[model samples]
Target: MTKRFLHITTLFVLMISVVLTGCGTEPAANDSGKLQVTATTGMIADLAQRVGGEHVEVSALMGPGIDPHLYKASQGDIQKLQQADIVLYNGLHLEGKMQEVFEQIGKQKPVVAVTDQFAESSLIASGVGGGTHDPHVWFDVKLWSGALDRIEAELIKNDAAHQADFEKNADAYREELAELDQYAREQLAQIPREGRVLVTAHDAFGYFGKAYDLEVVGLQGLSTDSEYGLKDVQNLVNLLVERKIKAVFVESSVPKKAIESVVKGAKAKGHDVKIGGELFSDAMGSAGTPEGTYPGMVRHNVDTIVKALK
Candidate 1:
């Protein structure tokens, strides 16, 4: 009787252990048998979806017009990250507030940065010691293409079964990016060198300026976390007047008031500077629109800048 009781207890314990282990295990692919991917921003989501193709399901935590600088992870975002088979984000502190959440999620699964391929020498320096990097590497078409390769490798790492599909999709997208780069050069070349000054709400255009040979001025620093004072506005106004800049741009993600203030300040100094157009910075345009796609966004910006400054 004693031996039989011991055997029953051992069986019960083994069953409980199995249940707990199953609960902790990662989930399999979804009903569609696609690798589930969650990206922190729409740009990353679009890239992942395009690269992953039919073998992956991708979604964005922050959607159109959302500013990643100030965005924080919500409960829904947390839940999505927890359930995702893989997570991709734009690193270099672009998602400033969500770092801790991302780190926590990384413990469970792969949390990859699309921009991690950029070498330190390739990054734009920011801040006191230049210890930090500007996270807006997407503005440079050539630089962003590198991310395609990285994303492909990651997808393959997670779902080796779909390696062929990911590679094919990435190759096709790379060709499209090359064409977009050429288009931007042609459009921007139309603007006179003297008129190639790009003034925007913040310092999100360093990569764009470097790649296209434009001088970029932002009202605020690289990260929008810093405050902008009247002195800063006055300084930019003086620059616009001195340089005879015709147009300044407002960003879709940043508040327009800062750019508007600069315009007002310039006008007060007897220089009429017009608001060129709203540019997609930090965030892409609404989905289903031409501006919503990466290629479309770059073309729209180039056209807007050329038409305004030419």
Candidate 2:
């Protein structure tokens, strides 16, 4: 009787273990034919979705207003990366700490750096040495439009079956981006020559300013993750005094203290200064907001710059 009871308990345990094992072995819940697309930031996700359309299940690793320059991944993120059919990142050292990880993963997966398509001359100096790459290539709609061509090319390479669909969606989005670019030029007409200056939390908008013909001054350098030195603050004070620029801007991702200091400095010098508006520097706004999408983000930026400068 004791032997029979022990045998019954062992069989019950085995059955429970098998049941648990089957539960664990259950396949991924999502049963869609959609591509498991992952992008480093919301901007890239939006672009990839526009190009990939309904065939892809697009997701952003970094949500709106999240800083890519210092973004780090979690265990869940690793699983997502591994599962992704295509892992798209801005890839101008934008992910900063995670750049090395993505570099390694690129060996196994299709990890395409969209920003690599930009010309070196178009990049800003790192200030670390003779050359540094600027990761904020999306600020300029023209530059972003150029990146889309590369994006389309790569998408076509990955999923050739949906080549026509991808091309169709990409072409339409590209046209919209072109139209947004034209709108930027038109809206920026609101600001006067001298008033076309943009003072911001960081130097992310160099491309945008250069393309739009504005004097772009950043309280900090290209990367927000970069520390500010005394010389940096002093230099900005001198420039602000000289330029007599009034509206200093703060970025949504960066701390406001630095720009606030500039505002205080300008005021101490008897110059009227104010926080222009928070700009979407590192990330986009919430999905439904004006800054949610790339074109809307650029449009918001143009409107803000013109409003502040004019």
Candidate 3:
């Protein structure tokens, strides 16, 4: 989990050069007649593939365990966006560095924010200035299902001939989401109310907490771009000791050092706080792995939390 930042001037120059030069292979409309789709995250790519089925070729800009908060667009990503027939991303400023790039690309093709269908009132404000909403809304299966509507609509609009296939796929996927939500509720309910506290490296589980009745705490802020000072560590340590919370978690995309420090602090205060397990926050698990997909990630989180807290 390296926190790397790219210079804005460098990125701007690279993007402009690419846009002006028109380098790289221009995406042909017919690669077996598949609609060229590019998504910013794996979750969005998975949705596009599921809905578009054989009719679309989807590419994800960010892969497993890559923190989007610190992710910057590369020359290759810019080329992919230019070649794509449609682009989809999670908009709450989640892709912190790529916002300007997405805006610039929107002028050329259909650039869609999958979560834009959500009303402002439904979003949780990122208390850190600049008016950002928590981007990890997929943790709540119900809210995530809403994304299917956007994906389906975009696919149909772009390729009207595949409207029937897109609708059929979306309906099946929604049913799977409903089952996943039920599975989450049933599994999470087993943990005692007091043991439902979830402490992690960053504040990425607000939606999960609201949907599953857990209390979440993070050493850092909504975006992993923020730092956790000694004061932040001390406060969390104090809370863990006072509440006798059994476990805290590490995120797959964020560094585990903050979580480990909190555990050490609690031990000094005569409390034993164990590192529960790694949770998928900003990114999903590896491709072909169980946790690589959305449902698998959520189920793994629920099982891990239940075992550690209960």
For every candidate in turn, the CA RMSD to the true structure comes to 10.5, 11.0, 2.6
- Cα lDDT tens digits, model 1, 1-310, are 1455345444544443444355464754478888889998887888898999888888898877888877755556655676689989999988865555566556668989888878888889887464888899999998898888888999999899888888899999999999999888888988898999999999999999999889999999997876899999999999999999999999999899999999999999999999999999888888899888888888888888998999
What lDDT score goes with residue 244 in model 2?
80
lDDT ranking from best candidate downward: 3, 1, 2
lDDT of 3: 0.87
Model 3 C-alpha lDDT per residue in residues 2-57, reported as the tens digit of each score: 33344663566467457735743344455478889999888888889999998999
TM-score of 3: 0.94
Q: After superposing candidate 3 on the true structure, give the runs of residues whose Cα lies further than 4 Å from its correct spot.
A: 1-6, 13-17, 20-29
Whichever of 1 and 3 has more TM-score, that candidate is: 3
Which ten contiguous residues of candidate 1 have the minimum total lDDT?
11-20
Q: Note the residue pairs that clash in candidate 1.
A: none
- Once superposed on the true structure, which residue ranges of model 1 sit more than 4 Å away at CA? 1-25
Worst 10 residues of 2 by lDDT: 19-28
TM-score leader: 3
Residue 260, candidate 1: C-alpha displacement in angstroms: 0.5
